[model samples]
Target: MEAAIRASQAQLFEAQAQLTKSQADWERAQNLMQANSLTQPDFDSAKLALATAQGKVKEAEQQVRVNNGKLTESKANVLAARARVDQSQGQVDASVAQENRSQAGVDSARSRTVGARSNVEQANVALGDIFLKAPMDGVILTRSVEVGAQVGPGTVGFAMADTHHVLVTFGVPDILVRDLKLGQRLDIKCEALPGRTFEGTVRTVAPEADADSRVYKVEVRVDNSKDVLKVGMIASLDLVDKEDSPRSIIAVPLGALMPNKDQEDAYQVYVIKDNKAKLRDVTVGRASGDMMEITSGLEEGEQIVVEGGNRVNDGQTVKVKS
Candidate 1:
């Protein structure tokens, strides 16, 4: 299905390129025909080519649409296959439990119980199938079953989400994914909670990039003790490196640093030493919002120019802005 989609997309591009060339040729033929420089047979041929190109473009577009639908159906088939596997596992577990219960019954019914247990074991081994199990530990978001509903293999019994440690899953560009690691703590801000900021750990970093988008999925797990963060809430997150250790670094406004033109990954900051603007090379770490952590070349209690540092020259005398 994916191959078909790719082929259709290629055909669409080829059709579009042909259409462009055909339109240009048809326009040129029109001008030549008006001037009596082109024969009627040649002009008609250009017109026919334009019409054919237009039809090919339309046909390619429809093929692409059809291929997309087939791709969606293919994905659904994969999900159904997984569901069947889960259901089979559940049935096996139920059979095992029944056998265990029957074995613990009275001595008088021991023979009957033995037969029943053997029958169950045989059925379990022969069929090799079971019902669905909840994928994770969480509250049921939706219950699709009633008291006595005849559920089949693919029937969804319940929908659940882990809200205790609410996960905010988002995609990051492949280029930036190299900097991310599991267990790294990040700061998350929810649109629902205006000024409040929440801390979350990077629970999952997808090893592969998405085929279509070329981005990797990253899930951040935030502790929702008070249930402040709910499911489906839109959140903005700041990815931070655990190596930075924000608590131990001297954080300053991001505006304070100026990029060094001659060097890569180097920045310069103006520090007020004895009331004079002194230039210092600093190694910057992870950034969170307006603040940036200084991993080296800056210390706590040092006065650094946060504003109007762009206009100040290195080692130049600058007035203190009240």
Candidate 2:
């Protein structure tokens, strides 16, 4: 489950980065075409790239929903398995007590006790099979069974995918593969999503190159919890030669930040202070997908307005939507 979650997260982030880039490129092309600086073919290409990026973003969002449902199902199955194990243990204990009380029917009682113990072992095995753990955390792309459906050995009930963290596989030149290593973080960009960049970890480097292509298959894992990246999105990968330390910051969705009318180039968020809208100017930092990092304006644990902010004024009484 963890692995599936990671893969999905990676795919989402990668897709989001690509979408941001593509949107920027498309906008630039639009401006250039209006100025008569860009050729018709170039502008058309940019327009197409933007559309593709939009599609990818939608696909990534769908994958996140599917993966979340599968995670919930798997957790429920684990709980059921534990219950079955406990029930089997109880049966074994009851059988032993019955055997101890029957002196005249010793042989018969002994046979029943042995059978009960065997059933307990079989139940344990069945319980183990019920776990349905994914190799890596991911969405269940296909589910082949319904509730209460009969299943047996070799029955495939569902297809599990790890999209939260996803493997981006691409062919790299044989020479380039030699310089790659496991656990190394790489910078990647998607042509469809033009201006945005994402980070990926080098998970696997194929030992052999394809005979015809003369390129080795390299797989990079990305985190996509932000729901920006998608599986099968085309990406350009590059090694990040230098590593930078990570930073933690409080951030909110872009919808939570509203334009400040009084001050240009400034933003405000309507925080619910004492059950009233307390609008305050905020400093913003880097934007990723739908989230903007709060640099200095908002504090942690404060509720910010996400919807219907325009309907209220500063210090206006407001009720939260159910």
Candidate 3:
């Protein structure tokens, strides 16, 4: 379209040049006719040439206008198409961000226990027997060392696991570790026990990511009083932040919100900072009645202008009413 406009403009310039030359020629012909030097046929031909040049100039100007109009329409269509692409990309990004993030792994305990009777029997032959007791009550799963094989410290005597309250451990990416906290609930599901969902509480979260996997380890403790979950069983964990057990959401009264004139489809509010009302841009989320959820740009315990917002201006000193 731009190329067409340029071509039309070039044609218009050429037509204007021709019109100038024709006018000069017609003037010379008129003077010659009055001085009786030029013939009537030649004078009539000059007049006709002048009129034809004028018509060509008008035609070129019209073509240039038409081409310019088409160019503007084409530009508008391009802008509309780009806007649609941007909107689609934004929706895709939001969906990815909103997706429930979780991780899964197979875990089993490995701590050992030594029987007191076996330790006493070996005490007569050896220099005092050392009895190893497990901290928790559970069944011993494996006994690695034989009886009196000259065992020392750090030897795996017997591996035991607490069945009454099993622990499910997994590793998650760095992004998920931030949201996880102690005592947070997670849904644990074992393949062996179908149609059963056990509630688990977060027991531990590794402070740093593992060097090899680049993920943080998280342990969840679940109630297994029914003895349904066994050792070496695989279980999948679902991080729970559902509506029934919703996480705390920061919100403000609807009256505090004000339109952001500089940006489209954006909002702002005046927050009381240091006894001054300061304008702040905030990303809003789902609204509930008189309260509006703020996804970003606001923190808990920060005071805001919930009433008479129109009277407040940004950076204006304000007094709090007791």
Tell me the number of clashing residue pairs for each predicted model.
6, 43, 1
RMSD of each: 21.3, 22.0, 38.8
RMSD of 1: 21.3
Sliding window of 10 residues with minimal summed lDDT for model 1:
124-133
Name every residue pair that clashes in candidate 3.
112-158
Task: Tell me the whole-model lDDT of each prediction, alpha carbons only.
Answer: 0.73, 0.72, 0.72
lDDT by residue (tens digit), candidate 3, 124-211 = 3232122344678787799696433677688788888779998886656555577889999877777567677889999999998766
Q: How close is every model to the real structure, measured as TM-score?
A: 0.32, 0.35, 0.31
lDDT of 2 by residue, 1-322 (tens): 5455566677788889999999999999999999999989789989999889888777777767666776776666556655655665665556657856545455554555566566556655654554356567566678797544678889898887766777787666544566789998888776557788889999998889765445577888888887677765656655322343566779887667777887644678999987899988877554455566677878888887887677668898887765
| lDDT, residue 144, candidate 2 | 97
Q: Please give the distance, in angstroms, between residue 62's alpha carbon in candidate 3 and its true position after superposition.
A: 99
The full ranking of all candidates by TM-score, starting with the best, is 2, 1, 3
Off by over 4 Å in 3: 1-136, 147-156, 240-322
lDDT tens per residue, model 1, 1-322? 5555676699899999999999999999999999999988789989999999999899889878876765665555555555555555555555556755543343434444455555555545433232234567676688797433677778887788877788887666555678887998888887567799999999999999766445577889899978788887766666544454425668887668777877644678999987789988886554556666676889888888997787678888877766
Q: What is the Cα-based TM-score of model 1?
A: 0.32
Query: How far off is residue 165 in model 1, in Å?
Result: 1.0
